[model samples]
Target: MPKTISFNDNWTFTKTDSPAYSRQTIVQGQPVTLPHTWNDSDGQGGAEAYYRGACWYQKVLTINAEDLSKRIYLEIGAAGNMGEVYINGQLAAESRCGYAMFRAALTPHLKQGDNLLAIKVDNSYNNEVYPLGADFTFYGGLYREVKLLVMDDIHFDVMDNSRDGVYLTQASSGEGVFRLDVRGRLVNEAAASANGRVLVQLKDHEGAVVWEDSQELAVADAAEFELSGSICNPVLWDGIEQPYLYTAEIRAIVQEQIVDTRQIEIGFRTVELTADQGVILNGKPIKINGVCRHQDFGGIGNAITKAHMELDMELIREVGANSIRLAHYQHDDYFYSLCDRYGLLVWAEIPYISFPSTLDPDSRNAFEQLELLIKQAYNHSSIYCWGVQNEITIAVETENTYRIIKELVAEARRLDPSRFVAQANINGVADDSIINTFTDLVGYNLYYGWYYGEIKDLGERLDDFHRTRPDKPVLVSEYGVDTNPNYHSYTPQVQDYTEEYQLLFHHNALETFKARPYVLGGYVWNMFDFGSANRKEGGEVGKNLKGLVTIDRSLKKDAFYLCKAYWSKSPFVHLAGRRFVNRHEQLNDLVVISNLQHIRVYLNGELLTEIKDGQPLNVIKAVRLILGDNHISVEGIDEQGERYTDEIMLRHVLESDSSYIYVKEEKTEHVVNWFERFDLSAPGQIEVKEGYYSIYDTIEQLYRNEAAKAVFLKYFAHVTDNPFFEVTQGVMSIEKMSQLVFYGIPPELLPVINRELNRIAK
Candidate 1:
């Protein structure tokens, strides 16, 4: 077995722009612990953008002389954007993409004792690195666990970045029979290659060896070998029903003695998406009840702990999510492992988000990141699809852009043919767009009622897309509205930041999905509100309130229940708008969301209405509001007579009560050019409007072609004054007046935006 130790304590950190290093810098550095970040405070607010530069971490690793004979390797769980590792002042390894795990061999660089291990982690805004511009904050630091693994000479290859020397992919052949394909890469440091023999075994839940296979191959320095076998009776890993897992032990033997061993968890299942059949799992059609998730939590800025990850997974499961779209980028390996153990189907991808101004470095980084993501996550059975890009149309698509996209999809298939390749497009991108045709299954991030059209428009647009792309499978990868728990609205409308509007938005979106079977899945934009750093809308600064739950996971919004009503099978009733206790409207709608058919609503002690066998959306009963506090109770009964009920106390206020009465009426000018905030001066308004027209003219002239300018205008036009959308769109309206006014935008973003604008300007 492999021996490992946590190397996470007693580290020194400092911010440095220079690449040069000195021992004095380390001695005077601030002391800190692992799971720490430099952007903890600065990255959470919109007061000023966080620092976009490099930082250094230094730690001393002491190794005994006797342990020097073992093969030693240093493993970093994660680093942000870019990281480089050094031992005893000598370069050991450097990793470009920071999300995945990387292992560097340290046997050659270590001394007898007291080896100095220095790591330089950079989250600086680099135009070459991916996510140069995305919605989420790119936190800087070595924010995850670091470890040292010691093993014998004959060991499995941990340097592949995937960290697994062994891989397992399983499929059901027939009744009670399964095919388990295994791939193992081995390294023999011993003088003679003839002494190496690899052993692979699969063990059941009871720890009994059910299948065993051994092979002897010609091994020089390193060799990759494959084994094909069959299991007579396999316990299938079905979603939520039976998340069964089998343990696999692969041992490398030299001269009949076990030298190194690796253990991996394996799940047997198959996933397929058909244009007409939707998602098929293990030969059964299953609708994907899914949600998109961001890595950061309330206090943790991407420095998530195991407990944090566990809680997030628990919450996702509680909300009845059968699948997860690991949005924008690859997550921690441990979280992917949890998905394997929990049987949540996953859509894993790289940070190839938004649009790229130039295809050179951004697409180059995308290719490298995709390689690392697939290599590290290849063995996970939970990943059914590999998402290639997200909303790249935010930037103008060019011939070079098309070339990069086609390359990514082809490379993903070449690397792992077992998983389907997918990508998410921005709204307004036509179904016949060339980019949509690159992926096996196409996904679009659409917000109909909230962004531009009515709720009913969701179904119509989906139907239109399906009719056009009848041979291709499609999914609504993201759809949501920002909702603040503190905000309440009687006449809710788009962008009201009210809980009522959130519920209605989801109710309509879910209804659209229910109407079309061709749309395989729909994932909510977010499961938990996340830190956007530069966001100022939604009644909260530096946060995206589109999540079903709060950033702290403290409160579940009313929309969460609306989703549960349709997605969950657990019979339960929840009173919507419990947080909005003070109501202004006399004709109040008392709504109850439940999976159960029969629900009875009671006002005070008297029965108001018996909603027998109501629709899955909601059970609604209108009531006249009293002047003071009123008690309301609702009970739902399942077929088995098991009852789930909820009650709440609501206070009715007169229309004259200014604090309780809330109404929203949208202005056409403000709605069309939504980027301008209410704080703009009369002169500033004229300047902004002029800048907007100038920006559009520049885009048209620079793109030259109608197609490119059309795509560019879709993202930049009507952008909110907040640069959050600007970063995502990658288009800077370089009207000088506009840039000077929007000073809150990080200084680093200006260079990127201006460079693209200047390209067109010239």
Candidate 2:
């Protein structure tokens, strides 16, 4: 189970540089939120604001043992910057890494009364290593979560699970063999002098033991073991369709007594990468249409909920984005689990961004944090690559940062050869000789068109890279220009972060990839706008809106839908009641952003349009196809113009759901006495049919008989998933609508939505 009571919010603060006990002071604390960097109050939310200093946070926790003799533990979900935990007046646990969970046994420090859990956080900007050296912000404070746990010392089990661990590899549709490996550390509190063996067993979903093994342990504390077992007639686990998971239980027996037991989720799948085919999963050659992401969300700042993370994943899935690059650094396990459960491929990385690491124990400690990351995120199948660094050339340009990165990648390979090693793209002719040999897959984070001038033909970049490094697979790790659409600036050059350039950047880059097969994937610079301490755009501080989705997550600029279209994930229609105000050369009734040649569009149960060679979107004069809940279908005809169609259902909302419009109508004004901040851009369109996303499919006939981009008319289907509008307003979040969008109805509607959302949210 996840650690209890996340440790991210509402903690006391102090500025402490050393671990000296006297540095611990009692100060009034501000209600802090996790998933947020500490500088939210400062200008740190901006992409260009630079703020740094040491800080500490304290949380009051109720520590209780299940049994009088059981041990209690204080688990820090993840500490941003650097931090130390103290119970009452004594040291309990300490950690660095803005991401990663660590625990310290608290039984010895707990008193018979209430406890004050103080965590000292040092959030200073280091120009030598990562974040500070990178382009994003390095927010402060203990940013993740902290948990209080109580368990038996002798029988405790730490089952940190995420994506792929070990399970049955299905032979056919549902048959396969099982492989199990259960691992954990055992602590010996009482003198159980006699030695024993830790037994690991694999059980099928039916509760039958498919395999079992035991490892003799002659020690305590951190005793590692391996249990190998295989199950015939295996049940392969998949996501969305046929989501299956096997349970691996571990039992440590000492002197005929069961001392420990734990369970973990395991999926059976294999991943491979090659220069010729890019990525191969389950024996199928696959290309990654991926997006780069940072965990911090808008509105709530960093104090995000599980529902928000799932919504992010759902957005990724909805766009048919098959992969995600955990860009720049390591993120929380919550996001990882969502990716794993959904079978989305991922590239998990460390915060080795921009600059060189602070040498000495600080860097070593960072290395140790990497070990914890491996143990914590090892089993996740979604993570296909372990990224060692991002743009290490900045630090390595002077010092040998690549030397250390090479060692780390080598170590990671030794730790788990099941996945590939990816070195974050570095500039200035990085020691490619070493990286090429050490890295299984090489990635380049080129900002040629962004930081530099616009590269006329981005696809030519693919061709150039292929020609230079033809043997190794290449991925465009970072692309997409920044765009602050709501606010406009008058700049003729593409340097202006306008909505047009943002959309145009993706359009050109994606078109480039469409012509190249050696390229495995390309992730946009980011998925959503995030908070950054070091940012200044339009002369304002706080929150960088470079994301396709705005900081508040209420709006999707033209680029957001453009990306969906170029991804070849058609038949999606959002904001169907409205058409894009701008006319682009590519928009079409049946848009085909691929090299597959001919395409046809249909509407209202009849064929309507076709584009081939270089037919423009306005063959109908304008890209706007008469907005409404119109039936649209698309057929991917072969070069010879033979057809294969896909259908889509869209809901058009011209008038508000209610006739006596609450806000739209200026009637009565309803006393209009409330003043609260709101994220107007969060909800764009909500599609509905028979209450939910009713996807109708048939053999020959397709959706509405024509290709319909769902972005225009399909955001109203599941009022349940978007109930976020009621309490939060706009689209509803799952946590809010869990009850409604289920085998049941959502919560009752609330007036003054976002205000009530904060109330019920508690």
Q: Estimate each model's TM-score.
A: 0.88, 0.70
Off by over 4 Å in 1: 16-27, 46-49, 174-176, 190-194, 357-362, 619-621, 655-762
TM-score between candidate 2 and the true structure? 0.70
Residue-wise C-alpha lDDT for candidate 1, range 10-127, written one tens digit per residue: 9988886445542334746888888877777566664556776778898887889778888889898878878888887778988778787787888999888788888889887666
Q: What is the lDDT of residue 608 in candidate 1?
A: 82
Worst 10 residues of 2 by lDDT: 693-702
Q: Compared with the true structure, what per-residue lDDT tens digits does model 2 show for residues 1-762?
A: 223444555666655444543235465545555544556555335343345676666666664444336666666666667667788878777666666677776777776656777777666654333344445555565556666555544543443321222222222232455455455555556654446787777777799887788888765554555555556656555433344666777777777777656666566765667667777766676777888887776545555678878888777776667788987677778888788677777899877655444334135644665566676788665677888777655323332544677678877887666667887564334323556566878777666566654655466656766777778878888776667664322121365665545655777676666667788878877888776654555333565666877766677666676666555433433221122222222233333332234666666678776656532111233343344545666666554545566565433334323211112223232223111123333443333333222221110111233232131123223332421122222112322232222222212222223222222211
In TM-score terms, candidate 1 sits at 0.88
* Every candidate's CA RMSD: 6.5, 19.6
Best by lDDT: 1
Give lDDT per model, in order: 0.78, 0.57
In model 1, the Cα lDDT at residue 2 comes to: 65
Residue 631 in model 2: shift from native, Å? 17
